[model samples]
Target: MKKTRNTQKQDYVIDILTNAKHTMSVEAILKAMPIKVNKTTVYRILERFAEKGKVHFVTGEDGKAYYALCNDCNVKHEMHNHIHFQCKSCKKVTCLPYEIEVPELKDFEVQETQFLMIGICDMCIS
Candidate 1:
C-alpha cells in the first residue's frame, strides 16, 4: 500500500511517543516532527488516532491533557470502558484498562465508554 504523508506523520508520532518517557504536548510533537505541520494538523491527526483506538487521552492537573497508545488484543477498544493513567509527577499518561471494568448498569445501555485513571507513574514517583 502506498503511504500518504499524513499516514507517515501519524506513524512517526506513534513511534516517537512509544519510545518517549513523558507525555508529549502539542509543542513537543511539533518541534520533534521533521515535517512542517500546524497545530490544527496535529490535533486532526490525534483525533484520528483516538477514533482508530490507536491512542487514548487524559487531562492532567494543569488542565492540559496528553495522549497514549491503547493496547488491546482480541477486543478492539471501542472507546468503551477503559482506564488511563496520568502520572502527576512525570506528567506522562499511560493507558491501563486492566484495573478497570465496564460499568454494569441495567438502567442504561452503554454504547461507548472511556475510563481514565490519574495518578503518579512509577517513573515519576521513583
Candidate 2:
C-alpha cells in the first residue's frame, strides 16, 4: 500500500518532530524537510498527528508555534505529558522538564501539554 499526501505528511510530521533535536516552526519544517510539499499539507498532517495523539504542539513565549514528539518512546505516547526544550544557541530541541506526578482531573481528561523552555543549551555553554 502507498501513503497519501496526508499519511506521508503525517508520518513526515512525526519523523521531523522525532528526528529534530529542537522544537521547530512550520517554516523550519518546510525548509529543512526534504518533502516538496506546501503549508496546507503540513497543517493537515499536524492536525492528524494531533488527532491520533502522536505528537504535542505548543506555542513558544515568542508567540511562535512549534511541535515535539511525545518523549515516551518506551511507553504509549498518550501517557507522556512532558514538554520540549529549545536551545537558543544550537537550536537543538530536546525533551526536558521531565515527567512529574500530577493529580488527575475527574471531569475533563488531560491529554497532553507542550511546554517549551528556550535558552542556551549545554552545547552552547562556553
Worst 10 residues of 2 by lDDT: 72-81
Q: Which model scores highest in lDDT?
A: 2
- Clashing pairs in model 2? 21-93, 22-92, 22-93
List the global CA lDDT of all models: 0.69, 0.70
Model 2 has a clash total of 3
lDDT of 2 by residue, 84-106 (tens): 67777776666676765545888
Q: What's the lDDT of the predicted structure labeled candidate 1?
A: 0.69
* TM-score for each candidate, following the candidate numbering: 0.69, 0.69
Q: Specify the poorest-scoring 10-residue window by lDDT in model 1.
A: 73-82
Residue-level lDDT for 19 in candidate 2: 83
Which stretches of model 2 miss by more than 4 angstroms? 71-80, 90-92, 105-112
